[model samples]
Every structure is written in structure tokens, then in C-alpha cells.
Target chain A: MHINMKIATKYIVVAILLVGFTSCQKNSRPNYQYMPNMYEPIGYEAYQESDAFANGVEAQLPAEGSIPRGNFMPYEIEDTNEGYELAKASLTNPLDSTQVDFVRGKELYDVYCGICHGNKGNGQGKLVQREKILGVPSYDDAGRAITTGSIYHVIYYGKNTMGSYANQLNEEERWQVTAYVEKLKAELEK
Target chain B: MKHVIYRNLTSRILSLGFIILLTVSTSLSAQEGDVAKGKSLFNANCAACHKLNKPMTGPALANVEQRLIEEEGLDREWINNWIRNSSALIKSGDAYANKIYNEWNQVAMNAFPQLSDQDITDILAYTAAPPPAPVVVDAGADAVVQEPGISNDLILGALAVLFALLALALVLVKRTLNRFAEAKGIDTVIEEKRTPIWKAFIQNQFLVLVTAIFFLLASGYFVYGYFMQVGIDQGYEPVQPIHYSHRIHAGDNAIDCKYCHSSARVSKHSGIPSLNICMNCHKAIGEVAAETQQEGLKEYGVDYNAEIQKLYEAVGWDGTGYTGETQPVKWIRIHNLPDFAYFNHSQHVSVAGLECQTCHGPVEEMEIMYQHSPLTMGWCINCHRETNVKVKDNGYYTKIHEQLSKKYGVEQLTAAQMGGLECGKCHY
Candidate 1:
């Protein structure tokens, strides 16, 4: 009986230890890799931390006045009130009727602008409806009769509480979205 | 009796009229503007740049009329002029207007020539109204959350005590029965000893061999499973610096994944969103609603406002403007492909028009992000073998697709038939 008790206690301890080992596999840390060197890149990966730059980051802003290669067109308007007024009056969509694709425009608009601007541009967006954001004006608002030029300017420079969306949408894509916004405005007016 | 009834009716009518007169007088004394109308107008026009009690892009505007009259010695006429055209007011060299313009970063307030005098009065009345009281969490909810934990422990304790008592009672009963047997002088019969069950089983050679073989096979199977999962980081969930709840943003708010990860549609990688993308909405949303905050605290154990403060710190936003001292948020990347394998986001996202959720799994339901797919080569090959290439409106693949369809003798060609299974497509 004494020998049986000893063996039973030993088995119980082993059972507890086994349970502990399996339960200790944590999800908060990464699993062990067989060969980490092959998995990790040697060259600088996007958003990697490095001492190579002054800022100690892999991502770097382009040098001032240096343009990107291929289809590069500079935005000349300064981010100021006068610049906004000038753009509002003068800026026009470069894409002609054949080039303007409303379907593509709507897709881009839904991804980028529809969260706050609403799917129909009537100011009652999901965010606005949830009261997370407010004071988003409708496209047909009389106080600010947004024109094609004005809409493009606001998107590029981001007037008031809005942020510039130039980085998200390319120049041609912006024109496409501008054309879509005009369509929404016409519908809202009707 | 008739005289008494008549008197009572006349008194009651007089009191009802008096109550009506009091209500009318009180409403007249209060601003002639409708409060409800003012609130709707304020939310529509002013809430973008201003909060009534907090300093947003503009200064807090609570009790502005009274404060302006007392402090600035300005009246309604000056305010109306400023509201209509602040730039014009500043151009006219009004001291207060110029002071405010410089104070708020020279950002010209949009001219609202559309608002008439009555509208302005209504808005001002709304502003003058007292701020709503802070929301108190329901005491019943707190009790409900706490009761289960207490009761569960209490029940367990009672069960344990009862079990111990029963065990003691059995031991006592057995000891008394043995005592009674001893007093009665009854001898308990002893049985002859035999080989133990384990000893008998060991003596059987065939049974021993079978048992040994079973143990070897079981251990081998376990070892294979352990070795196979060595490099694959399936269900890997690392803690991030900021606890951004995908459930709240993607699920509750229904924001598109592309809204933040804009580069996914055109680039090799689905880029981590910059702080500016977060600031776009967070500039206006300084704090979460009370219910949302409470929910976060109870369910997620997170202070959402504190997390927003962390975002502000990283982005260098000092409530009103950029402070120009920013720190990059070190987000731990989750889904990483090995350097040897070639993968492009735009090829799959823009070309195939695959939903982000296809590979990411039900991300909207995930509170903490994790690796959804095994992302092994076999898994990729399996998908390619099953998924037909989307050929419609794809000019680049139309001719090749037709050729491949004829070669395979199938109307729809799978990605594998389109040379997707070639090693050089990914490895080289």
C-alpha cells in the first residue's frame, strides 16, 4: 500500500508538470523559427528600425524639390488661404469625358471619402450618424456652394478639420473623384 | 350644493389659465430662440471646428455672449459682424478680432452670410444653455458583473466542505464497524495470494510486444506533429504598443480596410497607416462617448481616451496644432513572408479583386490581430488549383486565358493552369 501510494503521487506530479508545459505555450510571443535568417530580410524592410539614417528609421521623406519618376506633375498651389481661393477659381479636371470612369471613381471615393462624406454625399455618413464626427456639409450646401475646382482644392490641401488626401489618391484619380463628387452634387441639387 | 360646484369649476379654470400664462412668460424671458433648432444647427455648422466646453480648432464658446459683453466690452452687433466675415472684421483693424485671429493660427473662419439674425440668436441661445451632466454608469450593471464571480466561489467552497464531511463520515463508519467486529470476536477470512494483473500481463509475450509497439507508434506520431509545426507561426498574436481594436473600427464603425491601408491597392505591401490618417478623425473625436468608454473598460480593460492621448503624443498634436516634435509608432508587423518568396499586394488586390478578408480571415470579429492563415506553400498551391482565374474585363490575361482554356479543355481555367504552380513564379 505504501509503495502504491508513492507511485500514485509520482504519477500525479508528472500529470501536473505535463499540463503546465502544454498550457505555457503563449500567443503573445512569436513561435520559434527553424531558420530566422532566411525569413528576415537582410536589406532594409519597410518601416524597419535602423541607425543608417539621422532619424533612425528605414522610411524616409523625399528630398525637398525632388520629384518622383514617371508621370510626375507638380502641385504649384501653396497651402494657404490665397492659394485655396486661387485653386478654387482656376483648377479644372484634366481628364476628358472618355478618360473619366465613374465606376472607378466611385470605388476610390467609397474607400477614401465615404466614411465622413457619406456614400451619397448628403453629409449623413456612418461616422456622422454615430456622432463620432459632425459638421460635415452636404455637397448641395448653399452656404458653401462647392464647385469642381473648390472640391479638388479642398481634397488636395484639406481645408479646416479635414486632412489632405493627395497622398492616398493620385492626380488622375483625384480628377476622377472630383467628377464623381460633381455628379453627387448634381443629384443632391435635383 | 350647486353653488359649491360652480365655485370649484371657476377656481380650477382660473388656475389652469394661470399655469399657461406662467409657461408663456418663462419662455419669453428665456431667449426667444428654440433650443432644439439651435442644437441641430450647431452640430451641422459649428461642431467641425468648435466644441462648446473644450478648446478645439477654435476656443471654447460656452457663455460667449455674456463673457464678450463683460470682458471684451463687445455687443451682439460686433459678434454678428465677426460671424458674417471675420477676415473683413480683422481688415477693419478691430483689436479683439485681430487678437483672436492671431491667437488661433490665422486660420480664417468660414464666412456664414447665409445665417440671418434669428438663426444667430438661436445658436447663441443654444450655446448659453447649460452643459449636460456627466453620464453615470448603472449600479445594477456593476452588481451583475460582480455577483457571478462571488457566487461561483461560494458554491465551490460549500461543495468542497460537504465532500470533506462525507468523506470523514465514511471513515468514521468504517472504524466503528471494525470496532464492533473486534468486540464480537469474529475472525475475518484471509484469501490466498495470486500474481498481480500487471505481472500476469508481462508474462504474456504477445501482449507485451503489442503494448511496446503501440507506445512507439504513439510517441512517433506526436514527434512528427511537433516537428511539422516548428516554423509555421499560425495563430501568432503579438501584443502591439497601442491596443487598437479592429472590432470597434472595422466591425462597429464599418470602415473599409483600404481607407487606412491605401497603398495596398497599388503597392507590393499593405502599408501601415501613418499617424496623419488616425488624426483625420481623432482631431474631432477627442474622447469616446461615455457608453463606448465604459464598454472598453469593462470588456477590453482599456481606457480608450488614454489610447487617443498616446496617438496625440506620437503625432505631436497639442490639442490645437502640431507641436513639431513627433515620434514614430513602432508597430510590430504580424504577417511577414520570407525573403525568398515573392508576393505582391496589388497583384492580388487590384488585379484579382480579392477581398482583404479572404486571406485575413474574419478580422472584424478579432479584438486582437493574429495570423489567420497557415501561409504555407501547400496552402497557396491548394488555392491556385481550386480558384479559377478572373478573366472577365482583364485584357492582359484574355488571350493567354483562351489559349490555356483550349489546352486544358476546360471552359474556366484555374490559376494553376495559368502557370501559377511554377516554382519560378514565386521562388525565383
Candidate 2:
């Protein structure tokens, strides 16, 4: 019986030791790298931190008067009431009828705008339905009849509660979404 | 007969009086507006810009009529006109209207020309309604819930104590037996000792060889496992600066992955969303819902609202607008490939049209994000070897795909057949 007790005590000690060793492998920290130098980049990576810049971040805004490469057109409309009105009245879509791809437009719209402005553009979005956001006007709202130009302007400059989606969607993509919004608005009106 | 006629006439007059009283009371209530109807109206119309307690795009509208009457000396007529058409009111050179328009950065309020006087009354009633009481965490309920866990340990302890008592009793009984035997002058039996089990086992050459071989194999297996997982961080879960719950955003809200990771559709990297993107929704949502806050505290041991406050501080939003002071969040990158690897997010996410969850592994369900896949070269190659190339709707590559399939003599072409296995494709 004494020998059996000794064996049992030894087994318990072994079990405790195993638990301790396994518990030491915490998931909160990263695993040990064989060679960190090879894994880490020497050049400045996206969102890297560095002391070279004034802000100490690798990402920087474009210099003043710098133009992006590729087919780009600068928007002259200022972010003001007058600017909004002007854009709403005059800023027609540059893309001709043939260039409008409804499928791609729908895809982009669903990702960005459909969260707040319902996919059907009736203002009953997920956030609104969940009571997180409210008072999103429907596309077919007659009081503020949204034209294609106004849609693009609103997307670019972001009216009232909405934030500017210019960073997320490019000028061409913005036009695409504008076209889709018009389509949704027409459907809502029907 | 005359007395009966007088009694009937008196009863009829009382019934007429009661009908008049009911009509008056109902009319008074209609003018006051139903609180339930007002709440729905407020949420649907005024809620986007005007919150009851907080300043949003518009100012807080709690008891707005009384506050306006006292502070701005504006009446119900002025509010009615403003609600119908604020820009018109401003154009008409109304002093308070112009002041408010300028104060709110001239963001024109949408004209609710369709709203009747009754609708306005209902909305005003909603704004005037008293705020709901704060939810109190019930300590008694918490204690009740905790009882079962404590009882489990208590039960274990009780069993242990019972076994110890049994052991002690047996020991005492044995001592008594020995003492009795001694008192009676009787001998206790003793067994002659032989070679111990270990010594006897060591003497058996075949058994010793087999045990040694078994130990060697076991050790080798363990060593191989340890070495194999040296650089593969499959289950790496690091603590972030702010506790962002993807479960709440993606799973509960059902927001698409591409909503925040917008660049993944066009760019090489699935970039972390900027603070502006967070502000898109969080500007209105300063704090989480009460139930969500409770859930975070009870389940995850986190105050979700405090994390939102951290985000606001980082973004430098002083409740209403940007303060022009921003700090970039230092997010720890997970699932990073080595410097030599060349992975383009747009290629797989957009062109190939693969769901983000295919690689991310149900990111919506994760409370704290972790590396779900091993992300090893073998893992990547194995997927490439099995997954068929998405060739449908690719008119540009239809001829090439057909030719390739014909060359391979297969009905469907795997990504490997489309040069996905080329070392230069990923390495260079």
C-alpha cells in the first residue's frame, strides 16, 4: 500500500508538471521566430513607424499641388451649400450610357452605401432598422429630390451626418455608385 | 306616468353629459399626442441629426420647445416654420434661424414639408418625454449565477473530506487490530521480499529493449512536432490596444468585410481601416447599447463603451467635430507572410472572387482576432492544387483557359495548371 501511494504521488506530480509546462505556452505573445531578420522587411512597409518623418509614420499625404498618375480629373466644387447647389444643378455624370456597368455599380454600392442607405434606397438600412442610425432619407423622397449630380456630390463631399466617401471610392467608382443610386431611386419611385 | 317620464328625461341628460366629457378628454389627449407614436416619429425623422441628450449634426432637442422659448424666445410657430423649411426661414432673415444655420456650419436641415401639425406635436412630445432610467446590474442575480460554480467545488471538497475520514477510520481500525493482537500476544504475518518489479523487469533483456525503443519513438515524435511548429503561428492571439469586437460589427450587424477593408478590392494589401471609417458609424454611436455593454462586461471582461472612447480620443473627435489632433493607432499585424512572399489581395479577393472567410476563418465570430490558419507555403500550395480556377465570366481569358484545359486533358483546370505553382509567381 505504501509503494502504491508513492506511485500515485509521483503520477500526480508528473501531471502537475505537465500542466505547468503547457500553461506556459501563452497565446497572447507571438511564437519565437527562427530568424526575425528574414521575416521582417528592411524597407519601409505599409503603415510602418519611423523617426524620419515629422509625424513618425511611414504613410504621408501627397505633397501640395501633386497630381496622381493615370486618368484623373480634379473636382473644383467646394464643400459648401453654394457648392452643393452648383454641383447638384450642373455636375452631370461624365460616364456615357455605354460605360455604366450596373453589376459593378451594384457591387460597390452594397459595400459602402447600403449599410446606411438601404440596398433598395428606401432608407430602411440595417443600421436604421437596428435603431443604431436614423432619419436616413429615402432615395425617392420628394422634398429633396436627389438627382444623379447631387448623388455624386453628396458622396464626394458628404452632406450633414454623412462622411465623405471620396477616400474609399475613386472618382470613376463614385460615378458608378451614383448611377446605381439613380437606379435605386427610380425603383423606389416606381 | 308623468313621474316615469321625468325620471327617463333626467337619465337621458346624464348620459349626454358623460358623452360630452369623453369627447373633451379624447380631444385634449390628441393635442398632447401619444408618447408611443411620438417615439416612433422621433426615431424615424429627427433622430439622424438631432439626439435627445447628445449633439449630433444638429443640437440636442430634449425639451427643445421649452428651451427655445426660454433661451431664444422662439415660439411654436417659429419651430413649425423651421421644421417645414429651415433654408426658407434663413433666407427670410429670421435672426435665430440665421444664427443656428451659421452655428451648425450651414448644413441645411431637410424640410419636412409633408409633416402636419399633428405629426410635429407628436415629435415634440417625444422630445419632451423624460429620459429612461439607467439599467442597474443586479447583484443578487449575479450571486445566484455564481452559486453553482462554488457548489461544484464544494461538492468536490465534501467528497474529499469523506474519503479522508474513511482513510483515517481504516488507519485507526488497523492500529487497534495491531494493538489487540499485541495485547493478546499474537504474531503479525510478514512476507519475504523478492526482487522488486523494476529490478525484475530490467533483467528481461527483450522487455528492456522494447521499452527503450518505445521511449525513443515517443521522444522523436514529440521533438519533430516541436520543431515543425517553430515559425508557424497558427493560434497566435495578441492583445490589441483597443478591444474591437468583430462579432458585434460583422456577425451581429452583418456588415460586409469589404465595407471597412475597402482597398482589398483594388489594392495589393487588405489595409486596416482608417479612423475616418470608424467615425463613419461611431460618430453617432458614442457608446454601445446597454445590453451590449453588459454582455461585453459579463462575457469578455471588457467595457465596450470605454474602447469606443479610446477610438474617439485617437481620432480627436471632441463629441461634435474633429479637433484637428489625431494619433494613429498602432495595430499589431497578424497573418504576415515573410518579406520574400508576394501576395496581392486584389488578385484573390476581386479577380478570383474568394470569400474573405475562406482564409480568415469566420472572422465575424471572433471576439479577439487570432491567426486561424498556419499560413505556411504548404498550406497555400495545397489550396492552389485543389481549388479549380474561376474561369467563368472571364471572356478575356476564355480562349487561353480553353487551350490550357485542352493541353492538360481535363474538364476543369485547377489553379496549379494556370501556373499558380510557379515559384516565381509568389517569390518574385
Top lDDT hit: 2
Candidate 2 C-alpha lDDT tens digits along A1-190: 9999999999999999999878757788777778899889999899999998999999888998888999899988998888888888999999999999999999999989998898998888898899888888888877678888789999998877788899999999999999999999989888
Question: In candidate 2, which residue pairs get closer than 3 Å at backbone N, Cα or C atoms, i.e. clash?
Answer: none
lDDT of 1 by residue, A114-190 (tens): 89989999988899999899888888877677888888988887878888898888888898999999999999999
Candidate 1: deviation at residue A128, Å? Answer: 0.8
Runs with alpha carbons beyond 4 Å of true place in candidate 1: A1-24, B1-27, B138-140, B148-192
- DockQ, structure candidate 2: 0.67
**Displacement of the residue B54 alpha carbon in candidate 1, Å:** 1.3
Off by over 4 Å in 2: A1-24, B1-31, B137-190
lDDT of 2 by residue, B224-246 (tens): 98888888888889899999999
* DockQ for the candidates, in order: 0.74, 0.67
Against the hidden true structure, what lDDT does model 2 obtain? 0.89
Query: Worst 10-residue stretch by lDDT in candidate 1 chain B?
Result: B132-141
How accurate locally is residue B52 in candidate 2, as Cα lDDT from 0 to 100? 93
Per-residue lDDT of candidate 1, residues B1-428 (tens digit): 47766778878999999999999998786668777898888888888888899888788888888899999999999999988888899999999999999998888887778788888888888999888776566565578877998999999999999999999999999888888988999765458799999999999999999999999999999999888887777898988888898988999999999989999999999999999999889889889888788788888889999999999999999998899999999999888888889899998899988999989999898888999998888988998899888999989997998887888799898889899999999997
